[model samples]
Target: MFTSRMFAAGAAGFALAAMGPAGTAHALHSDTFAADNAESAAVVSAQIADTGSLDGDCTGTAIAPHWVLTARHCIEPFPTPGGSVRLGQGDQQRRVQVDHWEAAPAGDIALLHTVEDMGLASYPTVSDTVPGLGAARLYGWSPDGSGKTTKLPVAEGEITELLDMSLFEGKQMINVDTHNGGKTQPGDSGGPLFVDGKVVGTLSASLGDDKDGMSDVAAYAVVAEQYDWVMETISGGGQGADAGTPGRGDLNAAWLVGGGGGVLVAIGASVVVLRGRGKSDAG
Candidate 1:
């Protein structure tokens, strides 16, 4: 279901492995974040870490004052005990502590309960129905090829496919085409896909055919499919019982890569390489 290699961005080694943009046209749009709550609302740059070191970066969305939504792979295997989310940018940019975490039972979705209110003017809500196949947009925090993080990049994507389940994790997914003209590179995992101004999915993985790791299509975990889990997890209250302090643990995660052969099911994101001393081997 994937190309020879599926490189994920955001993680330390992931950005280099995933290469750069594939299309000629730049898909960045500043107006996408111009709405109220703008800066902190997007839940930019989540630096997940344990007691050892910083794991990696992932994009997230502040759905509530104390809750941020992201891909489970960003904090899986061993839950992140402590981390910070970048709110606003430039002079206004500030890091807020993430005190707790909760992962969905069956999907790539997860929640990061922050210690402070995100201060979003208009928090984006999850959609109820399936996203109609058409125009859509995606937002994430990625580097600008120089290892320097870019201002939240918003790309114009098209919802081309809706599947009963994902090729990686068996969870419901949506295929967004950003190829030929615009594409998602590294550091985009856990990003949010906006369809009709509502959050429909979270960026899970990308599929490409080239060698640079530039992806023509992106797979998103359907938010509507995981709506109940997200709401219940958040409503259940403090930390969902699994949240705990950061501890020392080894992170050896794997991503599925395929080409013209058999398929493989990945229970985590397509790229889960940790960002510490060096790149860890795929589990």
Candidate 2:
């Protein structure tokens, strides 16, 4: 199964231990997000914290006015379906009470449900299939080598091949290159990758934690393969909706931590560290 390490092993000190990209950690690389892009429909950014300090965690997107999509491992140490999603920035910013959080039974993809509308712009999934060999653009809110933040930074590269790593068994993964410094770093977990004008993948993991935040390689879960589960979850046709929210309690009480809201509770990083490569059966 796609585990937490698959999403943030670099940041949490797992794969490529010394060579991670999350701030001398693991995989967020490239430049700062353009200021104009923040106003683009539904592209949201978030930072995770706790009662003690700001952990500066993952990033995600609004799939619906009440639903957010991110890497399953991003919610480390915290129980899903209970944390709050701090969406947007500046005057347009707001928070979505994540009442429902469910990881796909298999892949690194996960969904967050809000009790109320987030009123953000959501990216459309491509109607046609994503070509095997094509260029892709990575986006995220993680700070870069220059320590830039408050904007969405993007990196351009190609979706070279399908991943053949063990962690991705039975999972459709796209091996995106981090060549020339393009990458997904610390705090960039769960960010989206765009192809053409639609989202084709979700940021997963990278091979190093170099100071630039760009790793030797990066991996993403193909959005096309994950579309079915995403749709089912959004329409209430998925599993875990009625599972009831547990952990730190409801959003209201759980959010008030450290000083303000957004503190995550009990989310831990996974220990598995496996390499991803090309597969013979690119399905």
RMSD to the hidden true structure, all candidates: 10.9, 11.5
**CA deviation > 4 Å runs, candidate 2:** 1-32, 35-40, 47-56, 126-131, 143-149, 166-170, 208-216, 239-283
Kindly list the per-residue Cα lDDT of model 1 for residues 46-86, writing each as its tens digit. 76654322322567787666677877666653444577677
Count clashing residue pairs per candidate: 3, 33
Top candidate, metric lDDT: 1
Error of 1 at 205 (Å): 0.9
Give the number of the best model, judged by TM-score: 1
How displaced is residue 27 in candidate 1, in Å? 12
**Model 2: per-residue lDDT, tens digit, 1-283?**
0111233433331142311211133333444444554223455544332321122355667655566677765553354235455655455556655566666665666676767776533334421254477887766655332333344556677878876431223255577775455545455666777776666666766544344323546667666666766766665566533233221122222211100111111113322222211011011
lDDT of 1 at 246: 16
Lowest-lDDT window of 10 residues in candidate 2?
256-265
Task: Give the worst 10-residue stretch by lDDT in candidate 1.
Answer: 251-260
**What local lDDT score does residue 67 receive in model 1, on the 0 to 100 scale?**
73
> lDDT of all predictions, in order shown?
0.54, 0.48
Q: Model 2 compared with the native: what TM-score? A: 0.65
